[model samples]
Target: MRCAQFRTALSARLDGEPSGLPEVRLDKHVARCTGCRDWLARAQRLRAQVRTGTADGPSPEWSARLLVRLGEDRTGEQPPGPR
Candidate 1:
């Protein structure tokens, strides 16, 4: 498989989202391509970090603030004119 093709499916492969033929192809490509192998390693590390909570997790307050900001941006409002 071409590097671009393998790259496009790399994330899905790491996430176990590929299936059958694509999965096999990606697997073989990863095994043979050092570049793809590095990408897979980085993806796996990032996924593990996210799962283990070492990475930042969005808090409820942050989500609320982000939603409020998004709403304001969408409506083109000035957030109550900054008090």
Candidate 2:
């Protein structure tokens, strides 16, 4: 299978979805393909970050701005400008 297919399967696997490809086949391709290996590593890290909500998780300031905007949407008022 091509690298793209492998990468797609890798993403599916990471997402706990069925890849439709055998795990052994995926492992063999990743073992021989440097790009796939790197991709798998990066995908794993990203999955970890997403699961923990800390992959460059939103800053407090950003969260505050979002909250303010949401409140404004409900209240029909403009959000305050940045300080």
Candidate 3:
């Protein structure tokens, strides 16, 4: 399989959906291709983050900025709403 095909299959596999025989081909390609292997590692990390729910929460800076914006809005600027 080509790099593009492998990447598409890899994405599908990460989502846990059936990707048919193409996925096997992509997996084989990844075993032999360093770039594809690195991509797979990244995909696995992101997948783990999604599956384990570790990516669900917001960052501290987001809340801090929100509070600052809220304070500004209360002082008659604009609401602390999303852009």
Candidate 4:
């Protein structure tokens, strides 16, 4: 498989999304292609960080403010923060 196709499938597999390639094909490509192997490693690391709650996200305060804004919109009330 081409590097681009392999990379795309690698990402999809990591994301638990549907992939067209067989599992054996994906594994074989990663084993033979150093570049694809590195890409898979990086993707796995990032996925691990996300699963461990270390991925970047809005601060608690920011998330609270966003929730308040969403609630206000739903209830047709003015939100507290500057728009």
Candidate 5:
């Protein structure tokens, strides 16, 4: 399978869904593909953080910034700050 298919399967597998690839093949792919290996490592770290309640949460400051940006998007009026 290509890298994109492998990534989609990896996500499903992580979520305990049925990934089409068997475990052995998945391991082989992960072992050989440096990009996939790095992606898997990051996904594992993010999963760990979420499981342990250590995942980064958006702070109030960021949330307000997002709201402002979204408002600009809806109204076609740019906020008086950096784009």
Candidate 6:
């Protein structure tokens, strides 16, 4: 399956929704795909941030970085920073 498909499944899994795809298949893909793995990590972080509301909201730097990461994701580029 393409990375996009796997990403959709990942989002569903993260949200506790059925992905209609087998868990093993998704796991296998994430295992070897660095881009998807990174995407998943970023998504989890974003979710956590949302759940734990900040007093003043996300910082400008954080927002900008997120936008850049998302743009890179859409273009299939590996985002800069930690793996």
How close is every model to the real structure, measured as TM-score? 0.55, 0.73, 0.62, 0.63, 0.67, 0.65
- Candidate 2, residue 65: CA error in Å? 5.0
- Model 3 residue 46 CA deviation (Å) reads 1.2
Segments in model 2 whose C-alpha atoms lie over 4 Å from true places: 63-76, 79-83
- Give lDDT tens digits, candidate 3, residues 1-83: 47877777778877787665565676678899999899989888878898888876778778768767666533456655677
User: lDDT tens string, model 2, 1-83?
Assistant: 57999999989998899998999999899999999999999989988888898899778778767878666544467767765
lDDT per residue for candidate 6 within 4-75, as digits (tens), equals 999999999999999879999999999999999999999998888788874357787787788776665544
The residue pairs that clash in candidate 1, if any, are: none
- Return the candidate ranking by TM-score, descending: 2, 5, 6, 4, 3, 1
In terms of TM-score, how similar is model 6 to the real structure? 0.65
Candidate 3, residue 3: Cα displacement in angstroms equals 0.9
In the predicted model 2, the residue pairs found to clash are: none
lDDT per residue as tens, model 1, 24-58: 77788889999989987888888999889877679
lDDT of 5: 0.87
Off by over 4 Å in 3: 67-83
lDDT minimum window of 10 residues, candidate 2: 69-78
Displacement of residue 74 (Cα, Å) in model 6 is 38
Worst 10 residues of 1 by lDDT: 74-83
* Model 1 vs. true fold: TM: 0.55
Q: Which stretch of 10 consecutive residues in model 4 shows the poorest summed lDDT?
A: 67-76
lDDT head-to-head 1 vs 4, winner: 4
